[model samples]
Target: MNKETVEVIDRELLTDRDYVSPGLEIIKPDKCFPNMIVEDTSASDWPYLRREIPHNWYVDQRNNYVGFLSRDEANIVYNTALKFRGKRALEIGCWYGWSACHIALAGVELDVIDPLLAKEDIYESVTNSLQCAGVMDLVNLVIGYSPQKVEELAQQLQRKWSFFFIDGSHDAPSPLNDAIICEQLAQTDALILFHDLNSPDVAQGLDYLKQKGWNTMIYQTMQIMGVAWRGNIEPVQHQPDPKVNWNLPEHLPNYSVSNLSADLVKEFLEIVTAIRPYTLLGEARLFSLYSLAKKVCIEDIPGNFVECGSYKGGAAALLAFVIKRYSLRPRLLYACDTFAGMPDPSEVDIYNGIPANLTGFGVGALKAPIAENIKSICKLLNVEDIVVPVKGLFAETLPQYKSEIGNIALLHADGDWYESTMDIFNTLYDSVVPNGLIQVDDYGYWDGCKKALHDFERLRGEQFNLHRIDYTAVWFKKGNFLPN
Candidate 1:
């Protein structure tokens, strides 16, 4: 852990145009910001929010503000800490004091800690938000880096921390450091809330706590943003169920999408409907593609984008849309697949009940290859140049381009057969860069795919915490990008 002062970013890293993480499909707010209670606004614009908070203040704190965290998350924080009244609470990064104010509103006297709070350029807005929220009395400003502040609080506080909110340096180690500190400072029954569930760092921190038997539960008001807690208050058994499906949106759009711009997704969906007609993909998995792609691009993770199974090219098309919309051109999106439908299955796949027709049907032989359609669709979408199609079985073609397809950021394996899935897994799993996302589209529904994932985990000797968005698709994050 970096025990020195928090190294605050000199300027904002994200912009309004930057699709907020976990954003896919956009929902019109029934009531706009400051009033939106339970609705999700993960990958969305902030005009409403801009109007709510003063523009100058928003500009100053926009970089650090968890603008995606709306009222539902605030309520959860307030309620979680409310029970631990009179307890010492910690807000690791008090950006604009939105979350810190909410932490204080929970009725606990919370310490608002942030390295930027020490800057004159930031202190006024941070304090004003708390003051306006009527939480200044309940809040104590601690201007220091997150990791070092934990040590300071550990020595100053009389009792253990009952409520801990970690929303600071998103680097993997920071959350882990905060978690370790919380373990030392927490009462027997404590509640810890972590932001940025999409972030590999926060996710890893939660995993560390879970291994130690913390009652950790992740909640996605819009997208996996708030990870809530229930400590030793109850004697529930430690259930090692790592994969939980984020709640399905109550209404399904005509075409489900990701956290790309609503306008961009709409146009892309129209083109996808024309080309794909039937996208077995769901909203959750689709959104994962957008969020994952955006993170790799935004964080500038060293890798190219690859999709092992681009059937009719719905997913590859969505990726193209995001790449074009975000102006991430020059970075190629390699869409590899057999022009023919499915390649023959191996014994393992056959034993797992994969039929020849679904697993090994040729394009011209009753089942036609859709590579041309994918190309045509991409052409119409003005993203054909970016979609480099390799028309052959994954086993046959992936090996030839092993050198060409260097590091990968998002690997979506949709080949349902065990032979096909594992072939891609063995071939490309190593190429996924740190903080990249590998999403399997058939794990939940296909026994062969599930077996392949299990066998791979066993071979690696490390169990990856798989997260499900639906019955058929599952995703797990890779290594943290935080520097050691």
Candidate 2:
């Protein structure tokens, strides 16, 4: 027990007052800065966490409740829970119940604590919000402060949290108390999420936790939200092992007439023949390939999911849908892209002709709002917990992430340009486990993307082989690529 805990046990009321401040006067808001309420727009543009805040919603010094949780934040919570389905969870300071709702929707049982909700009116609103989102039944709400109420509930329920979120009070002692109690209740593989870690009060709490051996990963920007996972700290040794349906040929489309539903076959042929304005594969092929890749991987490999070059997140969106439909285990999916647009062509050694897609950056050919639309679909489908969006180019960002694909069964490379394609292939290829499959989007379509693939093969001599598909090519690595 620490000083505060000791003080509490010694019959003295430990002051939550220390968590509050008054003497220092800061500039008061003339008009509400509603932006503060939603997931701070300035928050790192990691696609999974990037969410839009309403203009009217602002953070009030006293009782701030304007901007609702951004769609992205809500989606993050949803997907995390989905990935940890059947795992126990605790969420401290669940305001408005958006994160809690996402957790429940992801099929995880939850115990949510919010002392502020002891007020009946707030309780009613919380219930209303959860009900509105159709997740009221998933939560076991504990209405009181931590240690006291949380401890009592833990004693009664005898539940241990595998995942915890500290989003309640962004103050010192309050969050510190939340962290202390959470530490006592977390399981070995537990993950703790802290909101507003950049704030002075919360930073103190985060600092204290870090001192106690918690590994913190900071997602900093407007308002820092730090995630600390409590577990055996070991260097991750990921080996990607993407697989194919040994029976499924690489070059052949999965859209064979025999396997398709009558309706689907008709729609596909119509689209392929250009009888319809859209090609199902042209319009939805990217995502469908993503879906197909994830399905093939999950069915064969034993690891999490990831996709590079996620324009409109179509591929990732398909991955989430498949994970949900199959009741797959370990439901997390990561999607990486330059949400603003593609990287500068000049910077890319290959793919010079690739037009800019949306952001006036890359080869401007792909649509801009597709990724946003994928997010919207994620919310609607209630699979937010299964998908995580990393916003940025593959070269600038993905190389840093510690992947869990020690058994990567499938990899989808859709950069469609040589530089981007080769970058991802070079960076992530070795991570693929044995017998893994790497699917390239523009293997046959783009000159640069194709050239990069061939060059990589020629330079390496025996890294992978081309499985010529009808419209695209699938490369299966017999062995891993040594990093340059």
The TM-score leader among the candidates is 1
lDDT of 1 by residue, 149-240 (tens): 77886787664677788888777688888888877788766767776555666666777777676665555333344343454331111111
Show where candidate 2 strays beyond 4 Å. 1-68, 232-484
Root mean square deviation (Cα) for candidate 2: 23.3
lDDT of each: 0.60, 0.53
TM-score of each: 0.45, 0.41
